[model samples]
Target: MNQPEILQLFRVEEKRSKSSLRQLFAVVWAQLKMMLAYKSWLVMDLLSTLASVVMYYFVGLQVDPHQLSRSGWGTSYLAFSLVGVATSNYLWACLTRLSHSIQHEIRGGTLETIAVTPINMLMFFIGLTARGYLVSLIYLVGVFTVGVYGLGAKLSFTPQSLFVFIILFVLMLVSNQALGLVAAGIIMVYKRGDPLVFILAAVNEFLAGVLYPLELLKRFPALQVLSMLFPYTYALDGMRRVLILGASVFDVNVLTDILVLGVFSMLLVPLGLKMLGWGYDRIRREGTTSSY
Candidate 1:
Protein backbone atom coordinates (compact mmCIF):
# COMPACT_ATOMS: atom_id res chain seq x y z
CA MET A 1 0.00 0.00 0.00
CA ASN A 2 1.14 3.61 -0.56
CA GLN A 3 2.30 5.67 2.44
CA PRO A 4 -0.67 8.03 2.11
CA GLU A 5 -3.09 5.10 1.96
CA ILE A 6 -1.58 3.51 5.09
CA LEU A 7 -1.89 6.79 7.01
CA GLN A 8 -5.47 7.15 5.84
CA LEU A 9 -6.27 3.64 7.09
CA PHE A 10 -4.73 4.41 10.47
CA ARG A 11 -6.83 7.57 10.75
CA VAL A 12 -9.95 5.66 9.84
CA GLU A 13 -9.22 3.03 12.53
CA GLU A 14 -8.62 5.73 15.15
CA LYS A 15 -11.89 7.42 14.30
CA ARG A 16 -13.77 4.13 14.58
CA SER A 17 -12.30 3.41 18.00
CA LYS A 18 -13.21 6.88 19.23
CA SER A 19 -16.72 6.50 17.93
CA SER A 20 -17.16 3.19 19.72
CA LEU A 21 -15.88 4.70 22.96
CA ARG A 22 -18.25 7.60 22.57
CA GLN A 23 -21.19 5.30 22.02
CA LEU A 24 -20.31 3.35 25.15
CA PHE A 25 -20.03 6.50 27.22
CA ALA A 26 -23.28 7.86 25.80
CA VAL A 27 -25.15 4.70 26.86
CA VAL A 28 -23.68 4.86 30.37
CA TRP A 29 -24.48 8.56 30.67
CA ALA A 30 -28.06 8.10 29.57
CA GLN A 31 -28.63 5.42 32.20
CA LEU A 32 -26.97 7.59 34.85
CA LYS A 33 -29.29 10.47 34.08
CA MET A 34 -32.32 8.20 34.30
CA MET A 35 -31.12 6.97 37.71
CA LEU A 36 -30.73 10.54 38.96
CA ALA A 37 -34.20 11.48 37.79
CA TYR A 38 -35.73 8.79 39.97
CA LYS A 39 -35.24 10.53 43.30
CA SER A 40 -37.63 8.50 45.43
CA TRP A 41 -36.20 5.16 44.38
CA LEU A 42 -32.70 6.27 45.30
CA VAL A 43 -33.88 7.51 48.66
CA MET A 44 -35.66 4.25 49.41
CA ASP A 45 -32.67 2.22 48.37
CA LEU A 46 -30.43 4.12 50.75
CA LEU A 47 -32.92 3.83 53.57
CA SER A 48 -33.38 0.13 53.10
CA THR A 49 -29.61 -0.45 53.10
CA LEU A 50 -29.27 1.55 56.31
CA ALA A 51 -32.06 -0.46 57.92
CA SER A 52 -30.25 -3.69 57.06
CA VAL A 53 -27.11 -2.38 58.64
CA VAL A 54 -29.01 -1.52 61.79
CA MET A 55 -30.50 -4.99 61.96
CA TYR A 56 -27.15 -6.60 61.47
CA TYR A 57 -25.60 -4.33 64.07
CA PHE A 58 -28.13 -5.45 66.65
CA VAL A 59 -27.59 -9.04 65.71
CA GLY A 60 -23.88 -8.54 66.18
CA LEU A 61 -24.54 -7.13 69.63
CA GLN A 62 -26.37 -10.27 70.66
CA VAL A 63 -23.44 -12.49 69.69
CA ASP A 64 -20.54 -12.81 72.07
CA PRO A 65 -17.48 -10.77 71.16
CA HIS A 66 -15.22 -13.64 72.11
CA GLN A 67 -17.05 -15.92 69.70
CA LEU A 68 -16.48 -13.52 66.82
CA SER A 69 -12.82 -13.14 67.81
CA ARG A 70 -12.53 -16.91 67.80
CA SER A 71 -14.01 -16.98 64.31
CA GLY A 72 -10.89 -15.03 63.25
CA TRP A 73 -12.78 -12.82 60.78
CA GLY A 74 -12.46 -9.87 63.24
CA THR A 75 -13.86 -8.72 66.54
CA SER A 76 -16.95 -7.40 64.79
CA TYR A 77 -19.69 -9.38 63.11
CA LEU A 78 -21.03 -6.14 61.68
CA ALA A 79 -17.85 -5.55 59.72
CA PHE A 80 -17.78 -9.11 58.45
CA SER A 81 -21.40 -8.91 57.34
CA LEU A 82 -20.84 -5.47 55.81
CA VAL A 83 -18.29 -6.88 53.40
CA GLY A 84 -20.65 -9.73 52.50
CA VAL A 85 -23.48 -7.27 51.99
CA ALA A 86 -21.31 -5.02 49.83
CA THR A 87 -20.30 -7.96 47.68
CA SER A 88 -23.92 -9.03 47.42
CA ASN A 89 -24.86 -5.55 46.21
CA TYR A 90 -22.49 -5.98 43.29
CA LEU A 91 -23.96 -9.43 42.59
CA TRP A 92 -27.49 -8.06 42.57
CA ALA A 93 -26.46 -5.25 40.23
CA CYS A 94 -24.73 -7.54 37.76
CA LEU A 95 -27.53 -10.10 37.59
CA THR A 96 -30.31 -7.54 37.31
CA ARG A 97 -28.59 -5.33 34.74
CA LEU A 98 -27.34 -8.04 32.38
CA SER A 99 -30.27 -10.43 32.63
CA HIS A 100 -32.87 -7.69 32.28
CA SER A 101 -31.26 -5.57 29.54
CA ILE A 102 -32.20 -7.87 26.64
CA GLN A 103 -35.56 -8.69 28.14
CA HIS A 104 -36.37 -5.05 28.73
CA GLU A 105 -35.44 -4.07 25.19
CA ILE A 106 -37.62 -6.81 23.79
CA ARG A 107 -40.56 -5.87 25.97
CA GLY A 108 -40.24 -2.22 25.02
CA GLY A 109 -40.04 -3.11 21.31
CA THR A 110 -36.50 -1.73 21.12
CA LEU A 111 -34.60 -5.01 20.89
CA GLU A 112 -34.90 -5.15 17.12
CA THR A 113 -33.62 -1.62 16.81
CA ILE A 114 -30.75 -2.35 19.17
CA ALA A 115 -29.94 -5.63 17.47
CA VAL A 116 -29.78 -4.03 14.05
CA THR A 117 -27.49 -1.26 15.24
CA PRO A 118 -23.80 -1.37 14.37
CA ILE A 119 -22.75 -1.15 18.01
CA ASN A 120 -20.85 -4.00 19.64
CA MET A 121 -23.14 -6.18 21.73
CA LEU A 122 -20.73 -6.52 24.67
CA MET A 123 -19.94 -2.84 24.78
CA PHE A 124 -23.61 -1.95 24.46
CA PHE A 125 -24.51 -4.19 27.39
CA ILE A 126 -21.61 -2.89 29.48
CA GLY A 127 -22.72 0.68 28.87
CA LEU A 128 -26.35 -0.14 29.60
CA THR A 129 -25.36 -1.72 32.93
CA ALA A 130 -22.81 0.90 33.97
CA ARG A 131 -25.45 2.94 35.76
CA GLY A 132 -26.55 0.01 37.91
CA TYR A 133 -22.95 -0.69 38.83
CA LEU A 134 -22.50 2.93 39.91
CA VAL A 135 -25.64 2.79 41.99
CA SER A 136 -24.45 -0.42 43.63
CA LEU A 137 -21.16 1.22 44.50
CA ILE A 138 -23.06 4.05 46.11
CA TYR A 139 -25.10 1.57 48.13
CA LEU A 140 -21.93 -0.21 49.26
CA VAL A 141 -20.32 3.03 50.41
CA GLY A 142 -23.43 4.09 52.27
CA VAL A 143 -23.62 0.74 54.03
CA PHE A 144 -19.99 0.87 55.06
CA THR A 145 -20.23 4.46 56.32
CA VAL A 146 -23.33 3.75 58.34
CA GLY A 147 -21.95 0.52 59.69
CA VAL A 148 -18.70 2.05 60.83
CA TYR A 149 -19.73 5.52 61.98
CA GLY A 150 -23.36 5.08 63.04
CA LEU A 151 -23.49 1.43 64.08
CA GLY A 152 -20.13 1.18 65.91
CA ALA A 153 -18.61 -1.42 63.63
CA LYS A 154 -14.82 -1.33 63.45
CA LEU A 155 -13.16 -1.60 60.04
CA SER A 156 -9.45 -1.68 59.47
CA PHE A 157 -7.87 -0.73 56.18
CA THR A 158 -4.49 0.32 54.72
CA PRO A 159 -3.62 1.74 51.33
CA GLN A 160 -2.26 -1.57 50.08
CA SER A 161 -5.22 -3.46 51.46
CA LEU A 162 -7.60 -1.04 49.81
CA PHE A 163 -5.79 -1.40 46.49
CA VAL A 164 -5.93 -5.17 46.67
CA PHE A 165 -9.59 -5.04 47.63
CA ILE A 166 -10.29 -2.88 44.59
CA ILE A 167 -8.54 -5.40 42.36
CA LEU A 168 -10.60 -8.24 43.81
CA PHE A 169 -13.76 -6.15 43.42
CA VAL A 170 -13.07 -5.57 39.74
CA LEU A 171 -12.39 -9.24 39.23
CA MET A 172 -15.62 -10.04 41.02
CA LEU A 173 -17.48 -7.72 38.68
CA VAL A 174 -15.95 -9.34 35.60
CA SER A 175 -16.76 -12.81 36.83
CA ASN A 176 -20.32 -11.81 37.62
CA GLN A 177 -20.62 -10.26 34.17
CA ALA A 178 -19.73 -13.62 32.71
CA LEU A 179 -22.65 -15.22 34.52
CA GLY A 180 -24.82 -12.30 33.53
CA LEU A 181 -23.96 -12.83 29.87
CA VAL A 182 -24.93 -16.46 30.15
CA ALA A 183 -28.22 -15.45 31.71
CA ALA A 184 -28.77 -12.89 28.96
CA GLY A 185 -27.98 -15.46 26.31
CA ILE A 186 -30.52 -17.87 27.73
CA ILE A 187 -33.12 -15.11 27.89
CA MET A 188 -32.55 -14.19 24.26
CA VAL A 189 -33.29 -17.73 23.10
CA TYR A 190 -36.08 -18.55 25.57
CA LYS A 191 -37.77 -15.14 25.16
CA ARG A 192 -39.41 -15.24 28.53
CA GLY A 193 -38.49 -16.33 32.11
CA ASP A 194 -35.14 -15.89 33.89
CA PRO A 195 -34.63 -19.30 35.48
CA LEU A 196 -30.85 -19.13 35.25
CA VAL A 197 -30.60 -15.79 37.00
CA PHE A 198 -33.02 -16.73 39.77
CA ILE A 199 -31.45 -20.13 40.37
CA LEU A 200 -27.91 -18.80 40.43
CA ALA A 201 -28.82 -16.00 42.82
CA ALA A 202 -30.52 -18.38 45.22
CA VAL A 203 -27.67 -20.87 45.04
CA ASN A 204 -25.02 -18.20 45.51
CA GLU A 205 -26.81 -16.65 48.44
CA PHE A 206 -26.64 -19.93 50.32
CA LEU A 207 -23.39 -21.35 48.98
CA ALA A 208 -21.25 -18.27 48.31
CA GLY A 209 -21.35 -16.96 51.87
CA VAL A 210 -23.28 -13.78 51.23
CA LEU A 211 -24.89 -13.62 54.68
CA TYR A 212 -22.35 -15.80 56.52
CA PRO A 213 -18.80 -17.01 56.42
CA LEU A 214 -17.63 -19.64 53.98
CA GLU A 215 -15.69 -21.18 56.81
CA LEU A 216 -19.00 -22.21 58.27
CA LEU A 217 -19.51 -24.52 55.33
CA LYS A 218 -16.10 -26.15 55.55
CA ARG A 219 -17.33 -28.84 57.91
CA PHE A 220 -19.57 -30.17 55.16
CA PRO A 221 -17.24 -31.44 52.43
CA ALA A 222 -19.99 -31.64 49.85
CA LEU A 223 -21.22 -28.09 50.50
CA GLN A 224 -17.67 -26.76 50.52
CA VAL A 225 -17.02 -28.43 47.18
CA LEU A 226 -20.17 -26.86 45.78
CA SER A 227 -19.14 -23.46 47.14
CA MET A 228 -15.77 -23.75 45.49
CA LEU A 229 -17.45 -23.94 42.09
CA PHE A 230 -18.79 -20.40 42.47
CA PRO A 231 -16.37 -17.51 41.94
CA TYR A 232 -18.15 -15.25 44.41
CA THR A 233 -17.04 -17.55 47.21
CA TYR A 234 -13.44 -16.66 46.61
CA ALA A 235 -14.16 -13.00 45.88
CA LEU A 236 -16.10 -12.43 49.05
CA ASP A 237 -13.69 -14.43 51.18
CA GLY A 238 -10.67 -12.57 49.80
CA MET A 239 -12.37 -9.20 50.21
CA ARG A 240 -13.31 -9.96 53.78
CA ARG A 241 -9.77 -11.00 54.61
CA VAL A 242 -8.30 -7.90 52.95
CA LEU A 243 -10.78 -5.32 54.19
CA ILE A 244 -11.76 -6.67 57.57
CA LEU A 245 -8.70 -8.65 58.56
CA GLY A 246 -6.21 -6.24 56.95
CA ALA A 247 -4.46 -9.11 55.24
CA SER A 248 -1.92 -8.32 52.56
CA VAL A 249 -2.47 -9.43 48.98
CA PHE A 250 0.75 -11.41 49.12
CA ASP A 251 -0.49 -13.64 51.92
CA VAL A 252 -0.50 -17.24 50.72
CA ASN A 253 -4.22 -17.84 51.15
CA VAL A 254 -5.10 -14.47 49.73
CA LEU A 255 -2.89 -15.07 46.73
CA THR A 256 -4.65 -18.35 46.07
CA ASP A 257 -8.01 -16.61 46.30
CA ILE A 258 -6.87 -13.98 43.82
CA LEU A 259 -5.62 -16.61 41.43
CA VAL A 260 -8.90 -18.50 41.60
CA LEU A 261 -10.88 -15.35 40.93
CA GLY A 262 -8.59 -14.41 38.04
CA VAL A 263 -8.98 -17.85 36.50
CA PHE A 264 -12.75 -17.70 36.85
CA SER A 265 -12.86 -14.30 35.14
CA MET A 266 -10.55 -15.36 32.34
CA LEU A 267 -12.39 -18.57 31.62
CA LEU A 268 -15.98 -17.47 32.13
CA VAL A 269 -15.81 -14.11 30.32
CA PRO A 270 -14.89 -15.57 26.92
CA LEU A 271 -17.26 -18.49 27.29
CA GLY A 272 -20.11 -16.24 28.32
CA LEU A 273 -19.46 -13.84 25.43
CA LYS A 274 -19.36 -16.72 22.97
CA MET A 275 -22.59 -18.15 24.35
CA LEU A 276 -24.25 -14.75 24.14
CA GLY A 277 -23.14 -14.25 20.54
CA TRP A 278 -24.35 -17.72 19.63
CA GLY A 279 -27.75 -17.06 21.13
CA TYR A 280 -27.95 -13.65 19.49
CA ASP A 281 -27.20 -15.20 16.12
CA ARG A 282 -29.75 -17.96 16.66
CA ILE A 283 -32.45 -15.50 17.60
CA ARG A 284 -31.74 -13.33 14.59
CA ARG A 285 -31.74 -16.32 12.23
CA GLU A 286 -35.00 -17.57 13.68
CA GLY A 287 -36.60 -14.13 13.29
CA THR A 288 -37.34 -13.85 16.99
CA THR A 289 -34.81 -11.30 18.22
CA SER A 290 -37.67 -9.01 19.24
CA SER A 291 -39.93 -11.68 20.64
CA TYR A 292 -40.84 -11.57 24.31
Candidate 2:
Protein backbone atom coordinates (compact mmCIF):
# COMPACT_ATOMS: atom_id res chain seq x y z
CA MET A 1 0.00 0.00 0.00
CA ASN A 2 1.00 3.69 -0.49
CA GLN A 3 2.23 5.75 2.50
CA PRO A 4 -0.93 7.93 2.47
CA GLU A 5 -3.12 4.85 2.39
CA ILE A 6 -1.18 3.30 5.28
CA LEU A 7 -1.50 6.49 7.38
CA GLN A 8 -5.23 6.69 6.62
CA LEU A 9 -5.60 3.06 7.61
CA PHE A 10 -3.77 3.77 10.87
CA ARG A 11 -6.09 6.72 11.60
CA VAL A 12 -9.17 4.62 10.98
CA GLU A 13 -7.86 1.87 13.20
CA GLU A 14 -7.08 4.37 15.96
CA LYS A 15 -10.62 5.74 15.86
CA ARG A 16 -12.05 2.29 15.93
CA SER A 17 -9.86 1.44 18.90
CA LYS A 18 -11.53 4.22 20.88
CA SER A 19 -15.06 3.30 19.92
CA SER A 20 -17.68 2.88 22.64
CA LEU A 21 -17.85 -0.87 22.33
CA ARG A 22 -14.08 -1.26 22.67
CA GLN A 23 -14.14 1.01 25.71
CA LEU A 24 -16.94 -1.02 27.16
CA PHE A 25 -14.97 -4.20 26.66
CA ALA A 26 -11.91 -2.64 28.31
CA VAL A 27 -14.03 -1.73 31.31
CA VAL A 28 -15.53 -5.20 31.43
CA TRP A 29 -12.05 -6.71 31.60
CA ALA A 30 -11.19 -4.42 34.48
CA GLN A 31 -14.38 -5.33 36.28
CA LEU A 32 -13.62 -9.01 35.78
CA LYS A 33 -10.36 -8.59 37.70
CA MET A 34 -12.40 -7.81 40.79
CA MET A 35 -14.90 -10.56 40.11
CA LEU A 36 -12.22 -13.19 39.61
CA ALA A 37 -10.07 -12.02 42.51
CA TYR A 38 -11.61 -14.61 44.80
CA LYS A 39 -10.28 -17.59 42.90
CA SER A 40 -12.49 -20.14 44.64
CA TRP A 41 -15.72 -18.19 44.19
CA LEU A 42 -16.68 -19.96 40.99
CA VAL A 43 -16.11 -23.37 42.49
CA MET A 44 -18.15 -22.56 45.60
CA ASP A 45 -20.87 -21.09 43.43
CA LEU A 46 -20.98 -24.27 41.34
CA LEU A 47 -21.06 -26.54 44.35
CA SER A 48 -23.84 -24.59 46.01
CA THR A 49 -25.83 -24.47 42.80
CA LEU A 50 -25.48 -28.22 42.33
CA ALA A 51 -26.57 -28.84 45.89
CA SER A 52 -29.62 -26.64 45.41
CA VAL A 53 -30.55 -28.41 42.20
CA VAL A 54 -30.25 -31.80 43.89
CA MET A 55 -32.26 -30.60 46.87
CA TYR A 56 -35.02 -29.25 44.63
CA TYR A 57 -35.00 -32.47 42.62
CA PHE A 58 -35.81 -34.45 45.74
CA VAL A 59 -38.38 -31.87 46.70
CA GLY A 60 -40.00 -32.39 43.33
CA LEU A 61 -40.34 -36.10 44.11
CA GLN A 62 -42.64 -35.29 47.00
CA VAL A 63 -44.89 -33.18 44.81
CA ASP A 64 -47.73 -35.13 43.22
CA PRO A 65 -47.31 -35.43 39.45
CA HIS A 66 -51.00 -34.71 39.06
CA GLN A 67 -50.54 -31.39 40.80
CA LEU A 68 -48.39 -30.03 37.97
CA SER A 69 -50.66 -31.30 35.18
CA ARG A 70 -53.69 -29.99 37.03
CA SER A 71 -52.05 -26.58 37.06
CA GLY A 72 -51.79 -26.83 33.25
CA TRP A 73 -47.98 -26.86 33.28
CA GLY A 74 -45.76 -29.87 32.55
CA THR A 75 -45.89 -33.16 34.45
CA SER A 76 -42.41 -33.12 36.02
CA TYR A 77 -42.03 -30.93 39.09
CA LEU A 78 -38.26 -31.50 38.83
CA ALA A 79 -38.23 -29.98 35.38
CA PHE A 80 -40.42 -27.13 36.55
CA SER A 81 -38.26 -26.27 39.55
CA LEU A 82 -35.04 -26.60 37.55
CA VAL A 83 -36.26 -23.98 35.10
CA GLY A 84 -37.12 -21.73 38.00
CA VAL A 85 -33.73 -22.12 39.64
CA ALA A 86 -31.96 -21.46 36.38
CA THR A 87 -33.82 -18.36 35.23
CA SER A 88 -34.16 -16.77 38.67
CA ASN A 89 -30.42 -15.94 38.77
CA TYR A 90 -31.08 -13.13 36.33
CA LEU A 91 -32.82 -11.16 39.07
CA TRP A 92 -29.68 -11.05 41.22
CA ALA A 93 -27.28 -10.69 38.33
CA CYS A 94 -29.22 -7.70 37.04
CA LEU A 95 -30.45 -5.95 40.19
CA THR A 96 -28.07 -6.88 42.97
CA ARG A 97 -24.87 -6.69 40.94
CA LEU A 98 -25.51 -3.16 39.72
CA SER A 99 -26.35 -1.96 43.19
CA HIS A 100 -23.32 -3.66 44.70
CA SER A 101 -21.05 -2.07 42.11
CA ILE A 102 -22.27 1.38 43.02
CA GLN A 103 -21.82 0.68 46.70
CA HIS A 104 -18.32 -0.59 46.07
CA GLU A 105 -17.42 2.75 44.51
CA ILE A 106 -18.98 4.56 47.44
CA ARG A 107 -17.17 2.47 50.03
CA GLY A 108 -13.91 3.17 48.28
CA GLY A 109 -14.74 6.91 48.03
CA THR A 110 -14.18 6.85 44.29
CA LEU A 111 -17.72 7.38 43.07
CA GLU A 112 -17.31 11.09 42.57
CA THR A 113 -13.85 10.68 41.09
CA ILE A 114 -15.09 8.29 38.45
CA ALA A 115 -18.22 10.30 37.84
CA VAL A 116 -16.12 13.26 36.83
CA THR A 117 -14.22 11.38 34.17
CA PRO A 118 -14.87 11.99 30.46
CA ILE A 119 -16.02 8.38 30.34
CA ASN A 120 -19.74 7.78 29.99
CA MET A 121 -20.82 7.05 33.56
CA LEU A 122 -24.15 5.61 32.49
CA MET A 123 -22.52 3.17 30.13
CA PHE A 124 -19.73 2.55 32.59
CA PHE A 125 -22.19 1.60 35.33
CA ILE A 126 -23.90 -0.82 33.00
CA GLY A 127 -20.56 -2.19 31.90
CA LEU A 128 -19.58 -2.79 35.49
CA THR A 129 -22.29 -5.42 35.80
CA ALA A 130 -21.60 -7.03 32.45
CA ARG A 131 -19.46 -9.76 33.97
CA GLY A 132 -22.17 -10.66 36.46
CA TYR A 133 -24.75 -11.00 33.71
CA LEU A 134 -22.34 -13.10 31.67
CA VAL A 135 -21.82 -15.34 34.65
CA SER A 136 -25.56 -15.65 35.12
CA LEU A 137 -25.94 -16.68 31.49
CA ILE A 138 -23.37 -19.41 32.09
CA TYR A 139 -25.29 -20.61 35.12
CA LEU A 140 -28.51 -20.60 33.17
CA VAL A 141 -26.96 -22.81 30.52
CA GLY A 142 -25.26 -25.01 33.11
CA VAL A 143 -28.50 -25.67 34.98
CA PHE A 144 -30.29 -26.39 31.74
CA THR A 145 -27.56 -28.88 30.88
CA VAL A 146 -27.74 -30.47 34.30
CA GLY A 147 -31.50 -30.72 34.03
CA VAL A 148 -31.28 -32.40 30.66
CA TYR A 149 -28.36 -34.77 31.24
CA GLY A 150 -27.76 -35.22 34.94
CA LEU A 151 -31.37 -35.40 36.10
CA GLY A 152 -33.14 -36.43 32.88
CA ALA A 153 -35.42 -33.41 32.91
CA LYS A 154 -37.31 -33.31 29.65
CA LEU A 155 -36.81 -30.14 27.58
CA SER A 156 -37.80 -29.20 24.07
CA PHE A 157 -34.94 -28.30 21.71
CA THR A 158 -36.77 -27.75 18.43
CA PRO A 159 -35.98 -24.75 16.26
CA GLN A 160 -39.32 -23.14 16.99
CA SER A 161 -38.91 -23.51 20.74
CA LEU A 162 -35.33 -22.21 20.70
CA PHE A 163 -36.30 -19.24 18.52
CA VAL A 164 -39.07 -18.25 20.91
CA PHE A 165 -36.72 -18.79 23.83
CA ILE A 166 -34.00 -16.56 22.36
CA ILE A 167 -36.52 -13.77 21.80
CA LEU A 168 -37.96 -14.05 25.29
CA PHE A 169 -34.46 -14.22 26.76
CA VAL A 170 -33.46 -10.91 25.16
CA LEU A 171 -36.66 -9.29 26.29
CA MET A 172 -36.16 -10.68 29.77
CA LEU A 173 -32.65 -9.20 30.00
CA VAL A 174 -33.74 -5.77 28.86
CA SER A 175 -36.93 -5.68 30.92
CA ASN A 176 -35.38 -7.04 34.10
CA GLN A 177 -32.32 -4.82 33.74
CA ALA A 178 -34.53 -1.76 33.78
CA LEU A 179 -35.18 -2.12 37.49
CA GLY A 180 -31.52 -2.87 38.09
CA LEU A 181 -30.57 0.55 36.79
CA VAL A 182 -33.11 2.11 39.09
CA ALA A 183 -31.77 0.10 42.01
CA ALA A 184 -28.23 1.23 41.27
CA GLY A 185 -29.47 4.80 41.22
CA ILE A 186 -31.07 4.29 44.62
CA ILE A 187 -27.78 2.98 45.97
CA MET A 188 -25.96 5.99 44.55
CA VAL A 189 -28.24 8.33 46.48
CA TYR A 190 -28.65 6.33 49.71
CA LYS A 191 -25.22 4.74 50.07
CA ARG A 192 -27.17 1.73 51.25
CA GLY A 193 -28.91 -0.68 48.89
CA ASP A 194 -28.98 -4.38 49.71
CA PRO A 195 -32.00 -4.27 51.98
CA LEU A 196 -34.08 -2.78 49.21
CA VAL A 197 -32.51 -5.07 46.64
CA PHE A 198 -33.08 -8.12 48.82
CA ILE A 199 -36.73 -7.33 49.34
CA LEU A 200 -37.36 -6.73 45.67
CA ALA A 201 -35.39 -9.78 44.52
CA ALA A 202 -37.22 -12.07 46.93
CA VAL A 203 -40.63 -10.70 46.09
CA ASN A 204 -39.91 -10.54 42.37
CA GLU A 205 -38.90 -14.21 42.26
CA PHE A 206 -41.99 -15.24 44.20
CA LEU A 207 -44.30 -13.14 42.04
CA ALA A 208 -42.61 -14.35 38.87
CA GLY A 209 -43.29 -18.01 39.75
CA VAL A 210 -39.63 -18.91 40.04
CA LEU A 211 -40.26 -21.86 42.34
CA TYR A 212 -43.97 -22.58 41.83
CA PRO A 213 -46.68 -22.34 39.21
CA LEU A 214 -48.51 -19.04 38.84
CA GLU A 215 -51.73 -21.02 39.28
CA LEU A 216 -51.10 -21.02 43.00
CA LEU A 217 -51.60 -17.28 43.02
CA LYS A 218 -55.19 -17.76 41.90
CA ARG A 219 -55.94 -18.30 45.57
CA PHE A 220 -54.71 -14.76 46.28
CA PRO A 221 -56.53 -12.52 43.86
CA ALA A 222 -54.69 -9.40 44.98
CA LEU A 223 -51.28 -11.04 44.65
CA GLN A 224 -52.26 -12.51 41.30
CA VAL A 225 -52.97 -9.04 40.07
CA LEU A 226 -49.72 -7.80 41.55
CA SER A 227 -47.76 -10.57 39.89
CA MET A 228 -48.91 -9.39 36.48
CA LEU A 229 -47.18 -6.07 37.12
CA PHE A 230 -43.63 -7.44 36.80
CA PRO A 231 -42.06 -8.14 33.40
CA TYR A 232 -40.40 -11.33 34.71
CA THR A 233 -43.80 -12.91 35.27
CA TYR A 234 -44.39 -12.90 31.54
CA ALA A 235 -40.76 -13.87 30.88
CA LEU A 236 -40.74 -16.91 33.19
CA ASP A 237 -44.12 -18.09 32.00
CA GLY A 238 -43.11 -17.73 28.35
CA MET A 239 -39.78 -19.45 28.93
CA ARG A 240 -41.48 -22.37 30.61
CA ARG A 241 -43.94 -22.75 27.76
CA VAL A 242 -41.16 -22.90 25.19
CA LEU A 243 -38.56 -24.87 27.12
CA ILE A 244 -40.74 -27.33 28.96
CA LEU A 245 -43.73 -27.62 26.64
CA GLY A 246 -41.85 -26.89 23.37
CA ALA A 247 -44.35 -24.19 22.52
CA SER A 248 -44.31 -22.37 19.20
CA VAL A 249 -44.09 -18.64 18.55
CA PHE A 250 -47.55 -18.85 16.98
CA ASP A 251 -49.08 -20.11 20.19
CA VAL A 252 -51.44 -17.49 21.62
CA ASN A 253 -50.06 -17.77 25.14
CA VAL A 254 -46.46 -17.48 23.99
CA LEU A 255 -47.29 -14.51 21.79
CA THR A 256 -48.94 -12.69 24.66
CA ASP A 257 -46.03 -13.34 26.97
CA ILE A 258 -43.49 -12.07 24.45
CA LEU A 259 -45.69 -9.06 23.63
CA VAL A 260 -46.11 -8.10 27.27
CA LEU A 261 -42.41 -8.54 27.97
CA GLY A 262 -41.47 -6.38 24.97
CA VAL A 263 -43.84 -3.70 26.17
CA PHE A 264 -42.32 -3.84 29.63
CA SER A 265 -38.81 -3.53 28.21
CA MET A 266 -39.77 -0.52 26.11
CA LEU A 267 -41.44 1.30 28.97
CA LEU A 268 -39.11 0.40 31.84
CA VAL A 269 -35.64 0.61 30.28
CA PRO A 270 -35.72 4.30 29.43
CA LEU A 271 -37.40 5.15 32.69
CA GLY A 272 -34.82 3.19 34.65
CA LEU A 273 -31.92 4.88 32.87
CA LYS A 274 -33.46 8.26 33.53
CA MET A 275 -33.87 7.42 37.19
CA LEU A 276 -30.24 6.29 37.41
CA GLY A 277 -29.02 9.52 35.88
CA TRP A 278 -31.20 11.47 38.26
CA GLY A 279 -29.77 9.68 41.29
CA TYR A 280 -26.21 10.16 40.12
CA ASP A 281 -26.81 13.89 39.79
CA ARG A 282 -28.54 14.09 43.14
CA ILE A 283 -25.55 12.61 44.89
CA ARG A 284 -23.18 15.01 43.18
CA ARG A 285 -25.24 17.99 44.19
CA GLU A 286 -25.37 16.78 47.77
CA GLY A 287 -21.59 16.26 47.82
CA THR A 288 -22.24 12.67 48.89
CA THR A 289 -21.33 10.93 45.67
CA SER A 290 -18.43 9.13 47.31
CA SER A 291 -19.87 8.83 50.77
CA TYR A 292 -20.92 5.37 51.88
TM-score each candidate: 0.90, 0.91
| Cα lDDT of model 2 by residue, 1-292, tens digit | 9999988986783333446676688779888887689769887887777777888888988998898899987789888888789988987788788888788878887777877766777668878888788778778878887778899989888888888989998898898889998888887887767899888988999998988899999999999999999888898999899989888999899999999998998999998999899998898899888677
Local lDDT at 285 for model 2: 92
Give lDDT tens digits, candidate 1, residues 216-269.
686899999999898888898888889888889898878998999999999999
How does residue 43 of candidate 1 score in lDDT? 94
For candidate 1, the clash count comes to 0
Off by over 4 Å in 2: 1-18
